[model samples]
Target: MLTPWRLFLCQMALNIFYHIAKEIGEMESKWRLLHKANIKLCSQLIFTFITWQMSGYLTTKNSSLCLGGQDIFATVRENSPTGEIIAHLSINGDPGASSIRLCLTGENADWFYLEGRTIRLNSSFSRTLDREVLGSVLIAALTCYEDDIIRSRYRIMVEILNENDNMPYYLEDTIQPRYISELLTVNSMVFTVKARDGDGDTITYMTDKSTADASYFRIDLPNSGMVILDKPLDYETKTQLQVVIFAVETTTKEKYSTTATVTVNVLDGDDQYPQFQPCAPVYEDGDHNICTNPVYSVNITETDEDAVLYFSPGPIHAEDGDKDILTPLVYSILSGDGNGRFTIDSKTGEISLRQRVENRLLTPSFRLRIMAAQVNDPKKYSVATALVHVVSENRFPPFFNKTVYKGFLIESSSPATLVTTYGNQVLVVQAIDRDFRDGINPKIHYTMQPLTGSNKLYHISQDGIVIAKTDRLRAFDRHILEVIATDEESGETAHASVDIEVLQRGQPVPRSPFGEERLFGDMNAGMAGGIAALVLLVAVTVLFLFLWLAKRRRERRDPADRGAVALGKHPNVEASSPIAPRHVL
Candidate 1:
């Protein structure tokens, strides 16, 4: 290879010689020397032109030399399978030398070896498209510009491109759906996902084979989201389910997925049987069976899921001749309207017997039918029946009060008292009933009243106590008080009377005698006492005046009294009259 300065020096020398030769061109020797220098100049120009053409040709080639479309471009793979590379080059073409030298010029371009080289083509050698080259290798090919003259050239081209071999995957590696239903609707978009391929064309859309009815779910072609809903759901038959969906590539058929599920719960409505929780009191060994006593009472209850619900039953009829339904019947009760033998509560669907049986009469069997009807409809109803067994027991009612007391006492304060008072002492009425506190239906009420002929002075308490309202008492008052106690459940009542006496602790004093004695005593003693008091006051005043006068006369006789008195007349002067001779006289 020739340096730029060497080539310049050679050209300068040639120019000087050619000018000299032209001056002497008439001689053959000078003409031949000029011709040789010109040829040498032509060869250098041609070599430079060939180098310029090779660079342009390689830069714009169709990636490779070919006749029928086979083009193999060099490629570089880095962090990714496809990346970018840059190249730089320097070339020296020696016109006089036999070969050209080629070398890469930059850090990245060092991978290519372009040392001394030459381009040679045989008569039959043609450009082939599929020739493979090892990396950045710089090859020089010769092109002749003129007859018998040749120049070596250097060429390089960079090829950066893409690949398509990556598998399809969820953009986030996981996905979620708004909801999953036992019966999903068609075309509902479930998720949005994406993936990448190194080969640039490896991915496509497909279904997840693991999912139920895999064909039922599909992925969108462009955006890679899913659409689902293969069938209808029946909550009654099937309440819940699970499903899996996937994103897949069309070419490689590779897939990744996330799973989701839906829950469908069947609600309980007003369809259950109106069960008659346990009814009737459990029998005890100590209870005695009685005719008018209550056998049992049942409270009814029902359930529903609807916001509002109601219950109804057929018309209620008495099992016995009496109108009391709270009392038990002697046999199994049947509803007249429905297909059942048990008696159902018209308000609440509770069933119970109408009567209690004696231990000897107790039977081991009783059959009854119960039904539940809708409150809104008369015909809409459901029926259930039950068989009951009665065991021997002693359930019975308390006895009535028969021992009556004497006539009731008469006094004030009796109407509202819970207990009656005799001489300010309250009296209690002892009574008894055998029914259990809870078993007593409707409650018992007692009422008391004085005999009709008795004076208006007597009254009875609201609780049936008879007492005297007036303070006036009399012997043998003999007031008749009536006691009536009625059972609220059986409507049976009993009546009795009590004799009462109104007596005081002391005997009564005569009103006239007492008034006269008090009046005479006050009049006689008060008059005598007033006269005696006046006489004593006059005596005291006369005694005080007499004693005062006596003390004055005694003081006049004392000469000491005159010495102490100062005289209007002087001691040395004589009085005009005898009685005035001296102050003492």
Candidate 2:
């Protein structure tokens, strides 16, 4: 293979020299001009021509200037600083090769400079030599000069070796933040990020291992740059997530890399069951909390029947776990229905008793497991425990101290301030339950029932303190609310009226024995009662005197008047009326 390649190269060189000799022969006059100016160069050329004729080829081309090829190849790494020596030049045919004079010229000539026998990079054109921009090879003409004339010329092909200089960049529109439903299956592709390396190195993708959301994702195929979900997504625990991806050049010793942020917008999916409110939240991710529903409870008397029950810690309410997707929910008494005695409203979640509890001595309490399920998807459901305590029948119902309560609220007060009455004292709406010794029944619950459609302006705490958001109320705004006190255990309730008036800022409350001055007018009732009694006495005396005068006048006018005015034992009167003998004057 070597011998045949050499013969072919020799033949190609012979044809190239033949064409050069024919051209030189035609430029005889120019050669003479050069011979006259520089005899040494002409004489050398003549000897070279004679030798070419004798050997039948220009073997001089193969000396050191030519090695059966026209190009002088060299290699240098890209990004090499200026003055970096990449190649050493030589003129092997000439004894003083190390000291030979050489010149560079071509498209890439400025990229290099000659120093003695060494060639170095000259990067005055850019900040640094870039393989991506300069391409694989840099080309230039390297010529050996003798006597200030070009003796031989060759092409310099500097191979630009690659380096891990550039960071990988994501291609346009290759990756973007995504909003995905939490119901997305595990191991599903969430993102496909593509990047390119200028050096054409193999790229490997990696997720940030130290982040919390990293465990939720995995890069199964390192080279594919596909991001997959490693676990289930729960919108209840986390609504949003961030992932950091790294595009790395693995084969490079320096391991160049670039990073970008990916946001996983977890949308709500109808995949979770309804949860009882006043949620019992647990920290699922240290940074975010996940909530679980709580149990419900209420009490009913042994004789309770056909009565609706209100459970506490809030009502028997369950909200869909997916907050954004509030699908309709229905309630049912899954267990402890009390043998068809207990019934539940499918829509309102109200538990009612259809039959009376026969005996409290036998059954003290009923454990009711109530289930709330989404109407669209019944399988997605949750059960809450309802404890119903069955106690003896209530002998007496609760009653408020006053049939009507008058509460005063300052318009300048904040939402958290309690309602006050005259003299700036806290106004309490209290109830008395004769059944309880202290008249304070633990089972009695108070609520401020709205008289109108809106009740958000005021709130009544369990202790019967009315709090109004005075910021939402104007001065002199009067609100009438019906307050109800119900026995939570006996299901007996009492109602009372509350007149809440909004007072202007800095307006003084009237001093009165009764709470509010307007509700109970300011008047001395004791003095007024005494004056009324004295007037009644005077009227009685005056009426008696007038009656006596009338009787005397009538008796003097007529005997009949005397008889009519006389008592049964009248004194001896005139005998004109002997028939009325008993008449007394």
Candidate 3:
């Protein structure tokens, strides 16, 4: 703190320099002819002002002068028995209030005393200022400076707060429907309803309808707000049910109840067995063995509350009501075959024959009882009775003997005698009856004739003739005769015929050809010549090979021969030049 008293001394020195520079300025303008002298005087005044402005260092060093917002205690000494008066500003430094200016009012307050004022200590200077008679003073600028010096010891603190500003709801609203069987046990996880919140905060769960098992449902973990079913579900008794859920926030405990209907549809399980209604009986019509048509109208039906199941029947389950447990009404067989050839529709309960019956040995009418089994339950069967009636139709056609015999003649050559050829002709009949021969008759009849050039005439004896009728016939001739048998009821008949051709008994006669003949008979001469030419070519090839071999041997033996000489010289010339000379010398 620079004392006001010291500041007074510095103010007086500053005023003196101020007045001297003002005087130098006034004198320099007045003495223009003494320009060099005026210039040096101006320079001296400028240097003096700069030195005085920087003179604070020589007075108080580097200590700060505290001024505002501080508390301090100051004291002043008037009479100094110890040779000089020292105005010591001693501050009771409160760490909280380091320094502050306090206007200390007192008597004789003519001087505002600044602290740390250095006055020259001398006997005469100390004589007027008293030391022991010191008085209290105010710490003005000095108090503030001390406050800054103590500020680093204390620290400041602050804080913020929380608020409830979030909302509670499921992030996803829609959910899928779940299906389960009514037969499921309790505590089974049929489905889990999940929900979420945008705030990532804790969430809660509730139920819209609390009347039925609502307490079992609740959100499980953190954000997994899911509804769990605590009981079993059944579809047969209860087809479908809705589970309404309400979501809430765990933190704020605020809830917005949204009824997301979790549909629990119960599915059908294997519950109902099949059952069947009764069917009608089957019958037969016409001759028993020839009956080829089935007759019946017996249908099988079934029903169940859970599900209408299938129906089935076995071979014993005939179309005839005699075999059925329940006979059909108003549906009767018009014409039926007695064979085991009938069936009934299990699902539609429509009774009809399996196929058009076709078998011999089967009865014309059937006294059968059709038995039908339930589609869902094959063990349960029912049966009914049928009365079969057989009607007689056309009898089977009559059959004749398969073999037919023709008469033979024993005659000599020219003017032959009439032989008994008719006696060799046997008209035999063996007829069969499909109706087991119900009093039917079969007979044989015959007539005879002799061929032309015959000598004697003969006649049938009326007991199946053995003689020929030469007067009405020619000798050595050909003829055909037939005998027929028929069923008396159907008029269906069968016949057998004899074909007679009288043959002369001797060696056969030879005949001559019509056109021309050659040496090779019917063979073509040009074709034969071509074959001879091929043979000649093969002979010539063999001969040429033999001659070539013979000539080659002769040339090898005769080395001096002309051909051998030519062969040797030809190779020499060819070896010398590949091109052969046009004319050899």
Per-model TM values vs. the true structure: 0.25, 0.46, 0.23
Candidate 3 has a TM-score of: 0.23
- In the range 369-440, model 3's lDDT, one tens digit per residue, is 544444444444444444332233454565544545455443334343333333333432344445556523
- Looking at model 2, which ten-residue stretch has the lowest summed lDDT? 60-69
What lDDT would each prediction earn against the true structure? Answer: 0.41, 0.78, 0.42
lDDT-based ranking, best first? 2, 3, 1
Most TM-score-accurate candidate = 2
Tens-digit lDDT string for candidate 1 (1-585) = 656764665567556666776787756576466557665565477557666888877763433221112111244432121112232222233333433222334333433332233211111123211113222332322232212332222233433333233444445443433334433446765444455544444444455557544544555563445444444443333344444444444553334322333222322222222223222234534322122212222221121111111222222222221111122322223433223323445664345433443332444444445444444433434344443443323245433455564333433333432223333345544334565554332345666766755665555543445555545444434467676666543334656776655533332222332242222222456686787798998999999999999999877775644644455544556446657446546
Question: In model 1, what is the error at residue 239, expressed in angstroms?
Answer: 7.9
User: In model 3, what is the error at residue 322, expressed in angstroms?
Assistant: 35
